[model samples]
Target: MIELSRVPDQEMWSISFGGDCANVAIYCARLGLETHFMSATGQDPYSASMRAFLTAEGVCDDLLLVHHDRLPGLYAIQTDASGERTFTYWRDSSAARGFHEVEGSAQALQNASEADVFYLSGITLSLFDRNYRAQIAELARSVRARGGHVAFDGNYRARGWADPAAAREAVASMAGHCSIALPTFDDERALHGDTHEDQAIRRWHDAGVDLVVLKVGAEGAVVSSKDGTAERVPIAQPRDAYDTTGAGDSFNAGFLSAYLAGATALEAAAAGNRLAGEVVMHPGAIIPAEAMPV
Candidate 1:
């Protein structure tokens, strides 16, 4: 979707390619991962731009499927005085929502089982109907069975679901097959009304997720595992954030980058916090390549 924000002298807009999983893939590639992104998009100017952007960012788009007759979705961001942004979307019939129906989707998903890790988010699930949700679950199961790690982020949006119960059910089912569960405390509270972080962690662990990384805003992130070990990774330093848009998403990229590179979960959480701290200081979900920590 397109992003618009305010500057000192006037309001301006910036458009870029952004979807949750795609966002992670971009950051991971920049962070030295051989990241491949798979998705469906229309054959439009924006879709063309997206493909080019993904390529220029060092992300592999070989699995991106093009729909002949549709348009990509668009969203607008409006920020408050506090820099917190609200969204307005026009994606009900976006070509990406029909990803399962895209010709190469099944093959691309099947091929994902061979990867070292597979990542997805609740927003990805919200694009599908009930049947496709089950298809995604089966794909996650396949990845796990083949000894590949499945990572999940419960990036929930109420507008994405038909009801709270279905959202909860679907998220739990996906969580059951994930080895790494990255969830935001605010989303968990909104979904299950859990009052504490530990409660949310237990729920994720109970669903068969072995490693849990729960992000709690500026408090940093909490890392836990099924082995009954847990630790809090506080922010390394205070940040003057301009936009909080992709903080959690980039956190996932940084944490996964560290974890897959053999860092302990606590270390990964700290890495995530460090990257997120940097991301929030920028105006969008992504920062310039030079802005990344050394």
Candidate 2:
């Protein structure tokens, strides 16, 4: 999606490439992962610019499909004084919504099944129909069968669903296939009536998720492992955020990067918090590469 972020207290908007999965993929690549982003785009100028941005960020685009008859999705972001953001979307007819119907879609799914980790969010599931969503779950099963991890973040957007029941069913379906679950507490409370982080964790574990990382904004995250271990990992140092746009996405990237590097869940959560701290200090979803901590 093309992101148009309104400059805080200014009458200007800064344009950039940003989407939930795309943000995570770029951050994963930046964290030295061999990341591949699979999605669809149009033959428009904004699409071309997005492609260029992905290439420059070192994110592989081998499975990106192009459709001549469609256009890319777009969204605008506005932030309040506290740096919390609100968004307006214009993506009903985006090329990515036709992903399952694209020419090379079958081959792309085949290739994606061989990945070491398959990461997706609730927003990704919202983009497709029931059949394609079932296909995605099958793909996740195939990846796990091949000894890969399936990570899912239930980044629920109320506007994306036809109703709350539909959202619940869709998110639950994906959660069943995920070995690693990263969910925000607020979203869980809104969607599932999860009164506490423990409720969220219990739900994920009951759904067969092996690792559950429940993100509680500001305070930190709660990590639950399949072995019946649970711990709360707090932010080392919180900052007065400039923008909270990509905090969760960046945290997912950092946590996965560290976990894949053999760090324990607690250690990985610390890394996630550190990276997220840096991200919230910036104005956009992505900060400059040089600004990234070593």
Candidate 3:
């Protein structure tokens, strides 16, 4: 969990744990994957509680790197009458920013080597400084070069990037390194400017991505492969969404879970849609465990 605080101008809303990678890790665990979160958090009471929560949720804790001097990151979400959401973040000096900057970097690299798939997002990339960012990217490539799969989500937030060109370059460079692309069409449209889903898939395919799972919001998802094949998979059911938070992450969890278990890409996408539809009907990213499907 990300440990958030919600505040409004009239009443104030403050909430935490809206990070994309953390949400995926949590959902992966709930979906029966042996998941581990690789990120930095403060050694404070709140961070401790956050670790406790993940441990209680059955996620592995050995990979969680704790910083004693810094504090955990925080963000606030503001929702208006039309149900639109905006965010204000206070994470400039958060512990996670210093993740790859650790002294014994070999230890961090060793921890990363154990995961079957290293799932990360554009947000995770944006959190790092230049040198550390390159190191992380190299690590991701090394993971895949060794025959381990890498999954990427282009969870782009324009506000998160200091330089738009840097963001584009980073994303383009890393796109090919991943085995799976869990792309949200909305974000892809915003980043690349009005490209069709086919064009987007082609872009990744040309860059050497083996698979692309293009999420089209309520339209469900489309799967495309490098071998000139494509298919559309609709959401399992029509839904009136309550909140769309964590829908993509949970979808990644469901889809990856099914894929890892040997389901077809289309079948995995259906699982993703089923999970996402159920999530949007409830508030927050992590819904009740009992509500999850088999």
User: On lDDT, who's better, 1 or 2?
Assistant: 2
**Can you rank all candidates by TM-score, best first?**
2, 1, 3
On residues 122-241, what C-alpha lDDT tens digit does candidate 1 reach at each position?
A: 998898887888988998998888888999999999999999998998898798889999999999999999999999999999889999999999899989999877788999896867
**Native-to-model Cα distance after best TM-score fit, residue 28 in candidate 3, in Å:** 0.7
The backbone clash count of each candidate, in order, is 0, 0, 16
Q: lDDT (0-100) at residue 62 of candidate 3? A: 77
Q: For each candidate in turn, give its C-alpha RMSD to the true structure in angstroms.
A: 1.2, 0.9, 2.4
Output the lDDT of residue 97, model 3: 80
lDDT of each: 0.86, 0.92, 0.80
Candidate 3 lDDT over 218-274, as tens digits, reads 899999988958899987687877667788999999999899989989999999999
Which model scores highest in lDDT? 2
Q: Per-residue lDDT of 1-294 in model 2, one digit per residue for the tens?
A: 999987766899889989999999999999999999999999999999999999899999998999888999999887787888888999999999988778999999999999999999999999988888999999999998899999999999999999989999998888878899999999999998887788889899999999999899999899999777789999999888888999999999999999999999999999999999999988879989988877
